[model samples]
Each structure stands twice: as structure tokens, then as C-alpha cells.
Target: MLLFDFMFSETLNASLVQSSLVCLATFSAIIWWLRPSRSRSLPPGPRGWPILGYLPNIKFSEWCNGYQTHDVMCKLAEKYGAVFGLKIGSKDVLVLNDYESIKEAFHHTNMNDRPENAMIKNIDNLGTGILFSCGDKWKEIRKFTITKLKSFGIGKRSFAENITIEAECLNSEIAKIQGNPFYSRPLLEPATLNVISSILLGQRFSYDDEELHFILDNLHRNGKVVGSGGALLFVPSLQIFLKDKIKEYRHNLDVVLKYFRGIVSKHQEEFDPYIEKDYIDAYISEMRHNKDKGKQSYLDVSNLVMTLGNLFAAGSFTTSETLSWAILYLTKHPEIQKRAQEEIDNVLNQNQPRLEDKPSLPYTWAVVLETMRLATVGPLGVTHAVADDTRMFGCEIPKGTMIMPNLWNVHHDPALWSEPNEFKPERFLNENGQVEEPPQLIPFGTGRRSCPGEQLGKMELFIFITHLLQKFNFKEAEGESPLTLEGSLGLTWSPTPYHVCAHSRE
Candidate 1:
């Protein structure tokens, strides 16, 4: 009886211990399941559904409701702070909303690379272009392109002469309109396209050319599609639903490339190594040199075609759109326009504005700066990628994470600019009546990957605006509804379609 009692007690103890172990494991698992899965060091963000992640949440933002992606991002920034994270589809995206964060993030060497997307990959097969390429390829092509652009007088007085010629052509085109209210884009786009064309192809097409019209039409359509189809970059699976848009975008791109390829072929047939007539000639010369040396080279015909496309697409549309926005703003605010014209008249004294006169025309320069700030073209400048595992704003950013610099938010931040929505050129002016460019006003962006055409763009704006204001007065069309200050977002943010009467100042 004693031995039986001992065995029974031992069995009971073993059974209780087994039950306790199972209960402990079950409790621990429940706790683990309930806890946040994100690491404490990661940037705080809204929880997302499995697989789909914050993609659905972003779609619900103003972007899907006919507003801009930058607007949606700004609203999210207000809720989640300046630096926020969102798991967009399978990608980790970190949006930097404030100027400091943007500056810091962009200045980092590891943050200089662009994120890969299905759209970019499809458009640039070998990824040889300067805009969307990465690593040594980007470095090499960009350096070579810059050197060639400078050699070709991109930001020099000689280039300003080319811009002046274009400006005169534009004025002549406007003069032919005879102060009639007309759509500005039709006139403005061809003018800007010609300026870039003069450098790239050593030629310019007349505004009436069918080829010019074809190129402009396709490019405009592509810009709209790029902005609308941005979601495909995040959720590539969305392509199934947006196949039509994808198809259209690709078609437009192919049309532009085909046109450029024909131009490049002509340049090749007429190639002169001794005297480089244009960027194409310079590139062809370098390509032949590389072939002669038998060195591996990125300077192939494919890269040249894509590079030319990048230059044209980037160089033409942005300046023209900004000028359009400036016209709209001036038309809406005639008083400001009058002041700017008065400044131009006082500075130039019936002479056409020149690049050398920029300092003398501070108010005019301020107007250009103010227009850029308010317009915020290229709102989300370009998506950057984290090249390696990094920590930013006290949070861990993993390798391959995408970075979005919210330039719109930075330009419109109420704390930085009083009445940020108001178009006040005086904001860029100081008590000394000089243009004061704040560091926060980074319209062309900052850092190594900033717009290469920045100086050229600024020169164009200065020369074009000064020349236009000097010659004509922009005013709203009679019988038309009041133009909205609100802009439609595309590859660039541009004013809604509005007609303006370029009443000749003469």
C-alpha cells in the first residue's frame, strides 16, 4: 500500500507539470500574436493588411479621389509626423516631408540611387539613361552628359543668346496672335522645345511642323499617364487593372523614341568627328573613340537615344509648364504683374532682358522664384532608394527602401512661408529690396541627383518672363470663367487649361 501511494503521487506531479508547460506555451503564443510585429526601431506608421499592406490605405487618400499623390502624402505627414513609413505593396517607402529631413536624406551617398519600377524598366530597358539609372552607369553617363552640356554652352552667355533667339521667336508667334486670347501651351511648348532642340540636334523645328506637334502631343499624353499610373510603381499587381494606361504610356514612349532614333540616325550618317555640331555629334565621337580603344562602354546608340529622350522630355515640358503657370498667376494678379513689368521696364529701359541683367532685375527674379515655389512642379521630385541598410530620423531604413521627398509639402509648409497658398513675390524680397532666396525654396531640389538642367531652366525662366513682360501684358480672356489657382498634377504640376490675352505692351 505504501509503494502504491508513492507511485500515484509521482504520476500526479508529472501530469500537473505537463499541463502547466502547455498552458505557458499557449499563453506566450497568444501574447506574441497580439504584439506589434514591426521592430521598435522602425519608423512609426499605420498598420496594414497582409500582402496588400498600406497600398489600399494610400488609394483611399486624395490621390485616388482626383487629387495629387503629394497632397495625400502631406496629409499623412500631418498625422504621422514629418518622417513616416508606409509598406506600399511589397516595398518599404519612407516619405520625407520636411526640408531638413529631405536635405539630410538626399545628401546621404547611400540615398542617391533611384528605386526600380516596372514602368521605368519597361521604358529604359538597359537602364542607360541618366535620370533613372543607378551606380557606376549613372555616374559615368551623368558626368559625360554634364561635361558635354557645359561645352555646348548650357549655362553660358552664348546659351542665353540661343534662348533670346527663341524668346524673339515666341514673341513673334504671340504677336501674330494679335492680342487674341489663346491657349498658351500650344505656343509655349514649341518655343521651349526649340531651345533644347537647338542644343541636342543642332536644329529647331518651326512651331507649325507636324513632327513638332506629334512629339509635343505624345509627350503631353505620356506626362499625364505617368502621374496617373504612379500606383503601378508601388503595386505592380495593379497593372492587371490598369493595362490600358500602361499600354498607352508605352506607346507614347515608343513614338517619341522612334522619332529621336530617326534624328540620331541622320546625325550618324552626317557624323563629323573633327567638329562637333551638337550633343549627338559629341556623343557619337566619344562612342567611336571607345570602340577604337576596344573598351567596354555605356556610350552606345541605345543609351544615346534614351539620353536624348530624357533631355527632351525633362527639358521641354517642365520649363514650358512653369511658364504657363507664371502666365496664369500673372493674369490672375495684374497688380503684381504691373509691378513686375515696371521692374523690368526700369531695369531694361526698352531693351530686351539679358542673363547679365539678372542682378539688376531682383524683383523680376523674385517673381520667377515665387512662381516656382507656388507651382511646386515635380512635387515628388523623384523617388530615391536606400542603397544600404540605414538609420534615418531615429528609425531603421532597410536596404532597397524607397525615399520620396515631398517638395510640395516643403514649399507649402505654413511655418516656412506666411500664407503659403498666397502668390506673393514680395515674400522672396527683403527690406533692402533684393531677392532673398531661402534655403527652403529648393524648386530644383538639392544634392547630387538634383535636376541637371537647373541653371538652364532658371536662365530660360528669367529670359522668357522678362522678355514677355517687357513686350506684352498677360490678362484673363473675356467671357471666360475665372481661372482657378488650383493646378492639375501630371509628371509636373501645371495650371488648368486657361486662355490668356497677351496684350502687346507696345
Candidate 2:
């Protein structure tokens, strides 16, 4: 009995000693970390918890099947000054809220380099497309896309012809509604998808096609999850622990990838140098020629497929949502809607409006600009990471710090935008009938990684809005009064599903 007690005592002492030693070592390391390295200049923000840093202060809720970190991050920036530091897991992220700091970091500083983070590098298939890529690969792809876009009738007669066909199809479909209150999802989403599909894939799917429906459904889910701040932004570490959400993300990507792979494979099997139909065919043909000559090429099948998916998602969703908002805005404010219709009628004159016609339709363009500003689809713009330890706005930002540019703040700031919340299109036009310049208008973002799809997106928006206004007079659906302005948070902040009446113009 005495010997057993002695053994127990020894074991207890050993455990206690080990625990004390561990505590001491942790304390010393923390002290060293707190000392602030001479080379490091992290931006100032609210102090965080022990070990947790500022994690608790970060609002992370999984209420709607995903995290709401972006909303939380914005609120934090409001509380703390624009450029603040946040410790998310082991990494430190700097939040740049106001225009001044974002301008300095993104523009004046012009450090448009890919962040050195594992997550970015981890996206397997999408290796250096026009988006989320850096250095040589990005430069080459971006330049190639710019040249290809111009060649592919992006701002030319062919593109306008394609848009006109899609717009007419959309008009016919909306006409079938017979002025009844109906959900915009069916008409708006499919029409926008068809426009982009025609542009990128060189084909359009019938509204009833089963395969297209599957593709749209998968894409919608992927966008929803990524757009949700929690899944992608807040608890990325905790994401591994959540098996179901992770599975969904992978499954969603896989399904989309399968469709993309099919496209790439078919393009490969039916390659003809003499005959190239669209962007995909051209890209595949170029890639094959490069490969044949023993040259290293960046636009491999995988990258091409992923880029298509990215383009489809961005192009389809943003344009559709913006048009939806245009309809909603018109319904809510009929005066503005009437003015837009008048402008379109006068400018178009029974002819399909081309991209060049934007100059003539100043008021219509202003409404589009204002809608972009007010809605700001990708609200918290894609998260940017610092490539190196840097100082900005008198703060010491460490390397691999995730950056959240609260574009919402920049867009809605009373100082920059007069009568910020009001849906005023006149703010976008000057007396001479030109797009009034605002150097800080960063809807497409700035720096090296700005959206390459800006021109295409603008064209889509212009055509869709013009066509819709010309054909229909939108009105609020019964019981859906006081149309909800709230957007579901995710990679893109989309308006909550609401029905509106597309009263056909007699």
C-alpha cells in the first residue's frame, strides 16, 4: 500500500513538473513575440486575447449554414480605424476600410503581387488563370486574354449581334409571364447565363436542358458558399473539422470541373487549325500549337476549364443580379425607370444598341454606375493578402496578412458620395455628358489583380438593362411590398429572392 502511494506521488510530481515547464516555455515565447521584431511594422489595431489575439472580437456565426465573417470584418473596421490588424488563426490580416489606405496600398504602392499563402496555392486546378495568379503566368494569361477579347468581338459588331439575340430571347420569355407577379430568378438568371454561355462557350442552352440546369445549380451553390464569409474567410481552419461543408465545397468544384473537363476534352478531340469557332476553341488550338513546338504553355486544359467556370460564375451572377436590381430600382422609383426607358428608346431607335452607344445613353449608363456603387455585388472585394511584412497607415502589417478592403465604406462614404444611400444616378454624370470621373471608383478593384472581365461585364449589364427597360414596365409584386434591400452574404452579396411584375409594354 505504501509503495503504491509513493509511485502515485512520483507520477503526479512528474506531470506537474512537465506542465510547469510547458507553461514557462509558452510564456517566454509569447514575450519574445510581443517584443515586436525590428524589421516588422504591423499596423495598429485593437489588442487581442491571450493566444487567441483578436479572434473573439471577430464576429463568426454559422447561423445560415455558413460564416458571416465579412459582415463582422466590416463592423470591426468601423469600430477600429480603417487599417487595423486581425489575428485569424496563426495568420495576421490587415483591414483597409477607407479609400485613402486602399489607394495607397493598391495604387500608389502598386504592390500588385500574389500573396504568399498556402490557400491560394492550394487551389489545384486553377493554376494562374487571369484571376488569383501572379508573376509570369498571370502576366502572360492577362495579355493573351486582352488580345483575345478584342479579337473575339468583345466591343465589336459580332458581340452586339450575339447580345441582341439573347436580349430578344429574354424579351420573348418575359412576355409569356402575361404581367403576373413572378420570381425574377427563372427569367433573369437563365437569360444572363445564356448570354455568357454564348460568349465563352460559343453556345447557348435551352432553358429546359437538364445538363444546363445541373450546371447552374452547382455553380449557384459554389458561389453561395464562397460568398458566405464563414466558410471561406472566418473559420477556414475550422472548415477541415466540418466534414459536410468541406465535402460540399469539393463536390461542387468537382461537378463544375467535370463539365469544364468535358468541354476541354471535346475541344481537344475536335481540334482543327483551319476552323476555330469561339474562345475555347481558339485557346485550345493555341495551347496545342504551343505544345507541338516543344514550348511550355500556361493555359493547360485544367486552367482553361477552371477559368471558364470562374468566368461563367462571375459573368452570369453579377450581370443577372445587377439587372435584377435595375428592375427593382425601376419598380421602386418609377420616375427613374421612365427616364431610363425614354433614354433607351431615344438612343436605340429600333436598332440594337452597341457598346459604342454608351456615350449617347448617358442617363442609362449613370443608373448602371449608381447601381454598381449602391449594390457593389462583390461587397468585400476578393480578399487580398500581403506578400511581405509591410507598414501602411502607421501600422505594422506582417507578412501573409489577409487584407479586407471595405469597398462598401469607400462606395457609401458621405464625404465621397453625395446623398450616399439615395439612388441618385445624376451623381455619375457631369454637365458635358460624360462619365464623371472618380479616381476612387474601384468597383472592378485596382492594382495588378483587378478584374479582367470588366469590359465584358459592362457590356452585358448595358444590353440586359436596355433590353429589359425597353420591353417591360416593372412593378412590385403584391405582399412583397417595400422590397427588401438586404443581400444574402457570400462571395457575392446577392439580393434576397423577391418577386416583381414585369408588366409588358402595350
The C-alpha stretches of model 2 lying farther than 4 A from their native spots are 1-40, 48-74, 108-110, 113-128, 229-236, 394-396, 432-434
Best by lDDT: 1
Residues 12-90, candidate 2: write the lDDT tens digits. Answer: 3576658854884687467755643222355656654343344444532334334444556556677876777755444
lDDT of 1 by residue, 419-486 (tens): 99999999988899988999999878898888889888999999999999999989888898888887
Distance from true location, Cα of 506 in model 1, Å = 0.8
Q: Measured by TM-score, how close is model 1 to the native structure?
A: 0.89
RMSD of each: 13.7, 9.6
TM-score of each: 0.89, 0.84
Model 1: clashing residue pairs? none
Report lDDT (Cα) of residue 364, candidate 1.
85
Taking all chains together, the TM-score of candidate 2 against the true structure is: 0.84
